[model samples]
Target: MYHSGRLGIMDDGQSTVLHDSPLSQFADQTAEFLRYHVLSAVKLLEFRRIDWELVGRLGQVDRLQQLLGEKFRLVLDCDAPQYYELALEFHSTFQYIHIFNMTLPQFAMATGFYTQQEVAKPVFVSLLRGVMKKQQDHCVMKEDLARFWVTIATSPFSNNMVASDIRDPLYRFVHKILAATLIGRHEDDNKVNHHSLFCLMCMVEGRPANLASIFAWSMTRPKKGGGKSRMFGGPYITWLADNLGVFVDYPVDRMHTGPALSLMELKSFQQAGIITCDTPPAWSSIVEGPQVQPPPGSAADAAMQAAIPS
Candidate 1:
C-alpha cells in the first residue's frame, strides 16, 4: 500500500511491515535531530575556527544571521580575549557584507546589536585611545585609521554622541600628532598631521563652539624659541581661517584680499579674546615688505597693524 495500490497477499504483508515501522514518527525525530546538530555546529564554530563554507550553507538555511547575531552579542558581553579573537575573525570575514550590504547601524538594528553608547561610552573611548596609542608604534595604517574615523563621524549613533565622551582622548591624540609634526620626523609628516586634523574636525561635527575652541587652542600653543621650522601648526591655523566660512557665517573670499587678511582676522579675534594666536603666520615671509593697503573701512585693515608683532 505504501508503494503500489496492489491488494494481493504480498501487498498485505508489505502494508503490515509499513504500519509497524512508525515511519512518520521516525521522520519527525530525524528532522529534530538534524536541527539540533546544526544549531550545535554553529555554536561550536563560535568558539573555534569558523568554517565559512558550512556557515554559508547554514545561512542559506536561514541560520547564519541568528548565529552571527548571537556571536556578536557574546562579543559585546564578554571581555575575554577569546571572544575578541573570534569577533575579529568574523568581522574580517563578513565586513564586506556587513558594511556594504547593510550599514552597521542597520545591521545593529536588525540584529538587536547594542550601540556603542549601550556598550558604554567609556569603554568605546578606551578602545579608541588604545588604537591611537598603538598607532604611535606604527602598528596602524593611515587608511584603516581614516576609515574608522569616517565611520564614527558618519554613523548615526556616533554622530550624535556627546563630544565629552571622547574629548580628552581625542585632544591627547591631536597633541601627539602635534608633537610628531614639531619633530619633523619625515617628509610626509605634515600630510599626516593635516589628515589627523581633518579627522578630528569630522569627529567634532555638530559642535561648532567646541570645534572653535579646539582650533584656537591648537593654533595658539606656545612654540619653542629658535626652532628649525614648524610645518603643522602655522598651516593648520591658516587652513582654519581660510575655511572659517565653512563652519561659520563669516564671508568666504571677503577676507582673502590682502596678503595678511586671514592673519588679521585671526588676530582681531585673538585681541577680542574670541580666539588666541601665539604662533606667527606661516606665510609671514611672503607677506612681508609691503603692508598692502586694506580696503577702506575694512575691519581686517584696522586690526592689521595691531595684529602683527614688531
Candidate 2:
C-alpha cells in the first residue's frame, strides 16, 4: 500500500502498487536502509536537508522548486483543475521519502554525519537527527566549533570518562566526554564556541577530522588533591595509526582502542591534534569517570567508592 499509493507523488495518491517502478525501487531501498541502519526513532524529515543539498549540488533544485511552487497549490485551491488536484500533492515528506536512494556518503556528507565500517554507535544516530544545517564537503569544517575547542583547552574540564584528576579538556573532548561545547562570553576570542549537533559529530576525513579530534587539546597536569598515584592504559600509545580508532574514525581496533595516554603524552598529542577532551567510556561500566550516583549510604555506593583507584 505504501508503494506509489500513499505517497501521492508518482501515481496521483491512488492506492496502486507498481512492483517494478522507479518510485517502488526508491521506496524499497529507503525502507531497507532504514531497517538495517536503525536511526533510533528519528523521523524521515530529519534528513531532508541532505536530499535538498544533493539536488542543489546536482543543480536541479530549481526545477524541483518550480514543480513544487506551481503544483502544490493544487492540493488546496478549491477551483483548481482536476489534473492538478489533491491527488497530486507536493510535500517535503515526499521529497524526503523519494531521495533515500542516494548512497550513504551522499546522504551523510551534507550534514557531516557518518559511521564506522564496523560497530554501530548510537551517538552518531542521535547526531544525524540533530544537525539540521548542511556542511559543504566532508573535508571542510564549520570553524566555530574548532575555535570553541581551542578556548576549552585553555585548561581543566570535566567528563564522566576520564578520572577527575585528569582534567585535560583535550582528553575529555576527544573521547566524547565533554558531550557539547561551551558557549560563553568571548568578545575577544576569534571563535565563539557555539555548541550544536552539526559541529559536535562531524566526521570529516583529515587531521583533526571530527570536533572530538579537533579539541584533542590538553594543558600541563597538576597533582591535584595532593595525591601521587598515576593513571595508565589508554589505547596504549603504540598501536598502528592505521589500525587505531577514535569516535568517528573507521577501521576500528576495538580492543586496543582506548589510546593508553596519560597526562604527559596527552599534552603532546594535544599539540598535534591527535587526542581530544575527555569523555567517559559511557559504554563501559567496568571503567568510571565522573558520574551521578545514588546517595552514599548503600552497599552499592560503598562498592563504587572502593572501586575508585587510590
Candidate 3:
C-alpha cells in the first residue's frame, strides 16, 4: 500500500485523512494516512503531532481531525511565495526549538560537550558547565535561554550545530515558543519542557535538524533532504543572502559552511571522550529521502483533468 506512500480515495470517511502530497502536513509525510488532498502550492499547515506516547500503542491521541485544528493558520493568497517559503522555515524551526528548550540539560549531557575541539577546553567547558546548571526541572527561564544562546553563539565548538545560522531569528523564535508558551497568569509561568535545544538551533538554520548528522528527521520535512545538495535555496540561506549578511555572504558563506552533513559524519564525531557511545545510534546512517506522492493540485485541478470514468 505504501508502494507510492499515498492513498487516492477521495471519500472523507470518518477515518480518512486529508493530506497534501509532496502530503504538505507542507506535503508527503507518513504512509499510514490517506494522501489525496493536494490543494495548491499555497496551502495551510495545521498543527503537528508530537507522538510522545510509547510507540506501538493502539489509538492515536491527536487523530487526523485534531491535527487539523480550528484556530491558527497561515494563508497565502496574493502573498509572495518567498513569504510562504519563510513560513515553512519557521514551522520547522518552531518544532525543533520547543523540543530542545524543554530538554536543555539532557541534551547537554549527551552532545553538548563535544564542541568539535573548537574552543579553549578550560574556558569553553566552564561556560558549558554553567550553562547546563541553568536547567531547572527541564524548563529554563527566559534569561536562562538568553544566556544559553550567548554561551553557544560565542563558542566555536557549537557552530552550525546549536544556534543554526546567523542567530537573530532564533532569538525571536526561542522567546515565542519557550518563554511565550510557558507564560501563565503572571506569577505561575516557570516550568518548561526539558529539550535538545542544541539540535533545534541547528534546525532553525533552515536545513532540517539532523543532529550531528546522526538523527532521523523528527518527522518528514525539508523534503529536499539535508546535505551539500540541500543548501542552495534553503530558508536560512535565503534569509542570510536575500535578507541580511554578516559572517555569511549568501553564496560565499554557503560554500564556506559546506552543505548540511550526511549520515556518514556520525562515525566521524564518535570520538573516544566526546560522544562516548558503546554502540552507534541505529538512526545514524538513516536518511529520509522524499517519497513518491500525489500530484500537487486542487479539486479544480482534478476537475480540469477529469475524463470521467464512463
Candidate 4:
C-alpha cells in the first residue's frame, strides 16, 4: 500500500487497496523488500521523507507511470466528477470530527484537560460515531480512513508478526517506539525535528543508490531512551549524519563502513556540497586540525558512567 499506492502519483486521492488487483503483486514485492532488507521501525520512519520525495519526483500521472512501468497497473481518474465533492466532504469532516472524538478524550488524558473519565468516554464515543457517519457519506473519507487505519494497525511500525521478520531488529523485540514519534508528529502537525527528516531526505537525494545501505546503517542504532543500554550503533550514526547534515567521508576499512573520517575528508565533503554546513561546531585548539566532539549523552559517556557507577 505504501510503495505502490501511497507513493504512486496515479493512486493519489484514489482508492488504495492491497488485494485482488494488478498492483497487488507489485505491492507484495515492495512489502517483501521492506521486510527482508529494512531494519526497524526507526529506519522506516526515517525514510518517510524518501517516500514523499519519490512521489514528488514523479509528480504527474504519466511521469509516475513511466517511472514505475510494469510495477503496477494504475488507471488515473482525472475526470471523475465526484472528486471535488468528495474532497470537500473529507475536509469538512477533518475540521469537525475531532471535537467529539479521540482528539478530545486523548487530549484530556494527555493534557489533564479532564480528570474524570466517565465524563470523557460517552462524549468521545458520541462524537466519534457522528464523525464516522460523516466519513461514510464521503467516498474520499472512506478510502483515506481505510488506508490510514490499515497502515496504522498493520504497518511495519506495528507489533504484529509482519514487522518481526525484518532483518535487523531493535529495542529487544518492541516496535513503533522511534517510528511512532515521527509518524505521530507528522499526522498531527506535519513538522518533526525539521532537522532529522530533512537531513535524511538530503542524504538520500545526494546518493540515491545508497538508500538501502544508509537505511540499514540507521537501523543499527536505536534512538535515545530506547530501553537498551548500547548506543551509537551503525544506524544511529547514519541518522546523526543526516540530522546534522555533516559530510562524513571517512576511511572505508574492509570491516568499517566509511568509519573514522579525517578532517581533510570532512572538509572536502563539506566543500563538495554534499551537505550544507550551517553553524558547524568550531574548535580553537587543533591537535587533530579538526576535532570531532561526541554528542551529549552518547555511548562513550554512558560507558564511562557504567564503569564508575558512582
Tens-digit lDDT string for candidate 4 (1-310): 4333222112134422222222212334443334322211111111111122323332433443342222011111111111211111111122223244444344333222233463355433332111122454211223333322232222322222232222211110112222222112212221222222222222212211112222222332223222221121233333333333433332112111212211122232233232235565221111122222222353434545568856
lDDT of 2 by residue, 91-195 (tens): 101233235554333333322223353115544333222111356433333353343233223423322112222233223322221121111111111222223
Q: Model 1 clash pairs?
A: none
C-alpha lDDT of all candidate models, in order: 0.28, 0.26, 0.26, 0.25
lDDT of 1 by residue, 1-310 (tens): 1211111122124221112221111233343233322221121111122223432422322332332233222322221111111211122123222236654333333333335354344332222211233344312334444443433332222223322222232232222333332212222321334334433432332111122222222333222212232222222223323332321533332221111111113332233232224453211111112233443343434566668998
Best by lDDT: 1
What is the alpha-carbon lDDT for the whole of candidate 4? 0.25
Q: In model 3, which runs have C-alpha deviations exceeding 4 angstroms?
A: 1-115, 119-140, 143-310
lDDT accuracy of residue 244 in candidate 2: 25
Off by over 4 Å in 1: 1-85, 97-101, 108-170, 174-199, 205-310
Clashes of 4: 3
Query: Which is better, 1 or 3, measured by lDDT?
Result: 1
What is candidate 3's TM-score against the reference? 0.18
| Model 4 Cα shift for residue 103 (angstroms) | 46
TM-score result, candidate 2: 0.17
